[model samples]
Target: MAVPQFQHLAGRVWVCPGDPDPEAVQAGVAVVADERGSVLIDAGQSPTHAREIQAALTAAGLPQPRWLVYTHHHWDHVWGACAWPGVEIVGHETAVPLLRTEAARPWSHHYLDEQVRANPRLGPSFRARARAMDSWADFAVLPPTRTFADVDELPVGVGLRHVGGGHAPDSTIVLVPDSGVMLLGDCYYPPPAHLRRPDDGLDLVLVRRLLQDDYLWYVSSHAEPMTAEQARSAVETT
Candidate 1:
């Protein structure tokens, strides 16, 4: 597998390259730092990915993240919490139940089998990674140590808001006040049925409000960052 590239977006903010294949679910991890410490927007898909992120941070002269905030409880975003042993994991209260469900296992053979059948070209590489992940006997879901209902302040002037009913039941958005960047995770896009609710207009309204703010950059988990104007236009058209 190719090593993911981390790009610096602004002062003390960097984003790792996201999965290029739409069929794949891995998200780019956002790293934000301040004098106090650093904070990771989302843990990567696996322990190996998490370790690579750590190395990148060290190379960039940023401190190990003091907090790991999950945008949602999807397997690809939250599975790497095991890599940061002592980091204070934070997420919306609803994510706890989702993470503890039986479906939240570290590696799922059934899911891999389906992926192989669906996309023959990418199946082999996906299966190879799956087999490696299976060997991680110590892998387990690490529930967030701190849970919030609506809004919470995090280290480094970062703020988290639980924007319910979007990409995931516990979908949240991370805001960097200083840089005017907001990590939208997978919230402002087409989501799985189980993860989406009927009242999508409310979510759109919230998104529009955020975009209208002084935010300069809007970063999506699976795509390159967009300017506030581009974000607003996309949301309105979609």
Candidate 2:
């Protein structure tokens, strides 16, 4: 896939579109900025993906991002943390232990191959992506520098809210109230296909919340921004 570019969505918000490459699935990265500096939504899938964000920001003439926030602990969401050294990383409190466990283990091409062999979730496609990366020399999960349970307010009035969903119990959304934009990571997506089926009840509950909240634009990790009408239909049909 071509390197994704950040498209301006609303006040102080821009998002790099997600990659559809199955072997290297990548989530969209959102940037919220003002005089306080920019805060990135998710760090992308790998160093190459993160650097794509960096290059896009530079090309757009935006300042370096000041913070990196994980919407959850999924590999595609948090594995790119090493690319943002010194950037304050934030995540839901539930993510700390999950990440720490991975941090304690050794990661190598062989280790990854073995993981794919032993873990159904990390299937053949995951192994393919691991082998495709230009390098894994700098890959590592740096646990969040700070974490919160329910809600955490950041500079520029951005709000990080933990609204755990079926895809991930630590799922969170980035709320840019002033701009009426909400960034929904993988929260609305169904659990991985190999995992237990999605909970329809849970999906409905979150969909209701999104509709009631009525954000002007809803950004999901794997798709383009949506209008209220579009967002509602998108989630309901999922």
Top lDDT prediction, candidate number: 2
TM-score of each: 0.83, 0.91
**Candidate 2 whole-model C-alpha lDDT, 0 to 1:** 0.81
The number of the candidate with the highest TM-score is 2
What TM-score does model 1 achieve against the real structure? 0.83
In order, candidate lDDTs are: 0.78, 0.81
Per-residue lDDT over 131-225 for candidate 2, one digit per residue giving the tens place of the 0 to 100 score: 54668686777888899999998876889999998888899999998888999898877776557554533366686676646479888888778
lDDT of 2 at 132: 43
lDDT of 1 by residue, 1-238 (tens): 5567678897667888767775556678998876687898898887777888888787777778889999998767876789887789999999888888834543566767776688675564465457436446567777788999999998568899988655677889998878878888988665653334466443566677667477889988888899888877877887
Report the Cα lDDT for residue 214, model 1.
72
Give the distance in Å from residue 182's predicted Cα in candidate 2 to where it truly belongs. Answer: 0.4
> Model 2, residue 135: what's the lDDT?
81
Error of 1 at 8 (Å): 1.3
Total clashing residue pairs per candidate?
0, 0
